[model samples]
Target: MPRALVIEDDHKIAELIKIHLKDLHYEIDHTLDGLEGYEMAKKTNYCLIILDLMLPSMDGMEVCRKIRANDIASPIIMVTAKSEEIDRVLGLETGADDYIVKPFGVREFQARVKAVLRRSLGKFENQSSTNNQIIEADGLSIDLDKRSVQKEGIRIELTPKEFDLLSLLAASPGKSFNRQSLLNLVWGYDFEGYEHTVNSHINRVRAKIENDMNKPSYILTSWGYGYRFNENI
Candidate 1:
């Protein structure tokens, strides 16, 4: 059975999540402290991580950042009581795969979990289909199977999301993708107003891969449409 971790301070909430996850056939580890949860996550490979935003020892945002920094690419579902747009946006920018606000119904929470898991599965499937495929343009090289990127013979480390975004664009050079399309293709969910998520990720990708952010050669703004890879390269 796949494993799941729940890092929630509220005993009742944690138990509720645990019960539902058990029903879903996931072997579960429950922790109320963020530091301990982080340690557990580092040691164990979990299929899903449900983390509360406000945690003792470490907040969820910090935990998410640290996990991504360490290259732990497990899908994470952030649980927050705050409903503000900034909080949700920050959570996503921090590397969370999804977030669910408190006071959410069980159905909504379950749907989010299913959606994240489905997306993870879809990533694996897509990778298999493109196995051994490599796209080269200018100095940039993307190995789809290895999920690695290189520029001018030097390795460039990218977050999982960053790699996905870059690979998607590179796979179809000159094909413009609107923010909504990118969001649906990359995030696996339609987050209506979270289009800024796409912008922030694009900026980060450019910062890493482009020689000049001011005049990027790889990814170009489509002018009133969205963004696309430079076919000229």
Candidate 2:
């Protein structure tokens, strides 16, 4: 059975999530402390992680950061009562694959979980089906199956979302993907006005892969439209 970790402080909320996840046939591990959740995540390979923004010992942002810093690529769904726009954006920026606001309908919550898991599974299938998995340009190498990147022969770590974003652009060289398009394609959700979230992820990827962020050579701006992988690289 596939397992999931739920790091939530509220008993009611955690119970709600646990019940639904069990319905999806997942083995669940529940914790009220962020530190314990982080430790469990580090030691186990869960198919999904349901993380709350507020918890004892550590905040969700720090926990998410630490998990991603360790290159644990499990899909994460950040659950929180805070529905502010900034909170949602920060959750994504911190490496959560998806986010849900509190007091949410059971249907919406379940839908988000299902969508994230579907996308995660799709990535694995797509990777395994392709024999030609590496895309190279200007000394940057992206291994599609392995989900790894090396810039100028030096391995660079990227969050799972970052890797997905980069892979999409690199595979379609010179195709200018507007922010909304990227948001839909990479995130599996159409967040209408949250284009800046895409911009933030792009900036982080550029910072890691570019020799100079000011003069980026791989990812180029499309002036009035969006971003594209440099075809002439």
Candidate 3:
């Protein structure tokens, strides 16, 4: 069973999540304080973390930053009452894999959790495989086995999700994948309704791969259709 750590101060919300996750056969551990949550995350090998932005001892953003700084790569899903776009972006920038606002449906919440866990486990499997997958396009080279990307002979540091997004687009250059499609492909089948996650990750990827994110060359937008990779580049 996959282990999950939930850092939520709300008793009702935390209990709801624990019950649902237990139904899905996940080993659940939870805390009502951010500091304790962060400590537990560092000491354990959890498959995923459900973290709330508001906490008694420490804020979730600080916990997230500390976890990333410590090289903890487990997937983190931020649960926040704050629905502001900037708040969501900040969570992602702080190394959160995904985020969901409050007043969310239970089904959607469960789906997001499953999706994150699946993606995390899938990455582990991919890393174990001996796949000769080095995608080169427009002065960018991505090595799947090594899990690294180089642009114009210079290595770029990318988050795990950023790397996945780039690889998906690079693998099918010129193919436009809608936000939902990309989410399902890169995130997992269980991911639902948060297309913004795709948009944010794409922007981050472009920042690393393109000289200017505003005028991206490798990953082009298909307007209403979605986003496509520049195969000719």
Q: Which candidate has the top score in TM-score?
A: 2
Q: What residue runs in model 1 are displaced by over 4 Å at the alpha carbon?
A: 123-160, 204-217, 223-225
Say which prediction, candidate 1 or candidate 2, comes out ahead on TM-score: 2
**Per-prediction tally of clashes:** 0, 0, 0
For 1-233, candidate 2 gives per-residue lDDT tens digits of 99999999999999999998988899999899999999999999988999999889999999998898787889999987664667778888778899998888778988999888766544643444667679899899998867789987888977768888888888878899999998998898788888888888898889889989999999999988899999998
Between candidates 2 and 3, the TM-score winner: 2
Deviation from native of the Cα of residue 195 in model 1, angstroms: 2.1
Sort by lDDT, top down from the best: 2, 1, 3
Give the alpha carbon lDDT tens digit for every residue of 1-233 in model 1: 99999999999999889888887889999999999999998999888999988899999889988887676778899988765668788888778888888877778888888888766544534545764488899999988767788999998877667788888888888899999988888887788888888888888789889999999999999988789999998
Best by lDDT: 2
Per-model CA lDDT versus the true structure: 0.85, 0.87, 0.80
Q: For residue 232, what is the lDDT in candidate 1?
A: 96
| Per-residue lDDT of 167 in model 1 | 86
TM for every model, in the order presented, reads 0.78, 0.84, 0.63
lDDT of 3 by residue, 12-78 (tens): 9998888878988899999999999999998998878999988888999999888877767778999
